[model samples]
Target: MQSLGLDVLFKGTNFLRLLEGLWVSVRISLISVVISILLGLVAGVLMTSKNIVLKAAFRVYLEIVRIMPQMVLLFIVYFGTTRVFGWNLDAEASAVIVFVFWGVAEMGDLVRGALISIPKIQYESAEALGLTKQQTYLYVILPQTVRRLIPLSINLVTRMIKTTSLVLMIGIVEVLKVGQQIIEANRRTSPNAAFGVFAVVFLLYFLICWPVSRLAGYLEKRWAA
Candidate 1:
């Protein structure tokens, strides 16, 4: 019997393929998070407005996003759109769309909460100082809001990175999918291949997420101090 080793990862271009898959996951997550942040900021600010129609519209959107499961949303974008609209959207694109929708809803709520948490007196004081709305937000409110936002947003980025694994369901050859492929290819020769491959995948995820988590914690402490 051949000795069990992690030779499978190093064989031919297997390891390179895994790295490529990991890069795909990272790329999708980064793009989705950036888009989500922009959309969330707009939605959150709109949500706080006094316009009843605007608030109601965004409220419905928030409720729909919160109520639906992400996997369901993924299927809807990936499968449902293709069947219903005859759109040939690729798996990675669908994954990004679903994640962006989810991220926007979550980040919007965070922004809204941060915005609302500011004491009413702060707004009054800014007005008293003859600060225009734009100046007030730019100089006073937004800075404070961003301090409260950074830690939470960083946590969301980690979530986005981890959640990219779900894209495998729709056939994106992400890291997790590549790991599974490696395990299958060596299933007969190396019985322990699955364990090693998955272990590496776990480590990769941990390595990517751990520092972001630590940064979030550090920022929280620094902000509080």
Candidate 2:
């Protein structure tokens, strides 16, 4: 124990601070995920429209999200925007904004794929049965879309949670940042503090994400049947 420097976690509220930092990450992720779901639904519907201009715009947005790294997006939103526009956005807010922007694009693509996967024959069958547009959606199309969507969207939540680690670059003081601070503070007395602190951080992240991933898997199987 002494050799590993795990004891440093017991020092003067250090562990508590780590938990607090983790909560900040979780809070940001939850808020962003909620906003992403709402907006992604709208963006997804727009993506399926027959209008060429609208499809082109969404395609461009999706391409930008895919090509640009999330870390770069964070820097642009948190650092560049303030320097360029003289805006005073807080760090947490900036993290949330960057994540939502990314999340919406990804989620929108998922939605588009789910919507398009339903065969045209299904729509034709619904029309033959005298189902109106809304009725067709509510009864036939939406039910299947939701089954495919829920598991994928739940997985996206875990992705967002893990990605929150990047927010530390923008000075959010989330879990990874807290671990760094602890290791730095204990460098002299606990030279191996980095190993123990980081190990714990990894455990915390696993504890949070494993169950979510499992739930997504279970839902995917359950719904597919």
Candidate 3:
């Protein structure tokens, strides 16, 4: 263990700190995901409207999100906004804001796709049966949209969790940051601390995301049938 520097994790409270740091990352992602889902639902519905100008605006927004790197977004929200707007946003809060901004666009796009995928025949059939538009959506469209959206949105959660590592760049002290701290603190005694620390960090990430990915897959398979 000393040869490989895995012992660094066993020393003092290093492992516990890593766990706590991971929770920070997870907590931020969870908050962002919830807010993103709520706002994205509204944005998705708006995107589907017949207003050409509205659709065009959403298209531009989506493209901008797709093109902008999350790291850049983090800097803009954490550094630029804090200085420009004088809002005094802390690192963790800034991380959540950037993630929610990014996630909302992704979730909105997924919702738009799911909503549009429903066959027009279903709408026509509901109308033929004397169903009002509201009733048709509540009964026919929403059920299917929820099914499709759930799996996709769950997958997005994993992405957001993994992406929260970027928050460390803004000084959030998340898992990766904790690992780096461990490696640096033990560098003289454990020359290979970096390897073991980062390897364990990777494992921790896998442990969290693997189950979520599997769940998404299971739902997608079960609901597709």
Whole-model lDDT values for every prediction? 0.89, 0.92, 0.91
lDDT of 1: 0.89
Candidate 1 lDDT over 90-169, as tens digits, reads: 88889999999999988998999999988999999999999999898888887898899989999999989998988887
Using all chains and alpha carbons, the TM-scores for the candidates as numbered come to: 0.94, 0.95, 0.95
The per-residue C-alpha lDDT of model 2 at residue 176 equals 92
| Candidate 2 lDDT over residue span 68-99, tens digit each | 99999999998899899999889899999999
After superposition on all C-alphas, the RMSD of every candidate to the true structure, in Å, is: 1.9, 1.3, 1.3
Residue pairs in clash, model 1: none
Can you write out model 3's per-residue Cα lDDT over 84-110, one digit (the tens) per residue?
Answer: 988889888888888888999999999
Looking at model 2, how many pairs of residues clash? 0
**What's the count of clashing pairs in each model shown?**
0, 0, 0
Ranking by TM-score: 3, 2, 1
Off by over 4 Å in 2: none
lDDT for 1 in candidate 2 is 80
Residue 130 displacement in candidate 1 (angstroms): 0.6
Stretches of model 3 off by over 4 angstroms after superposition: none
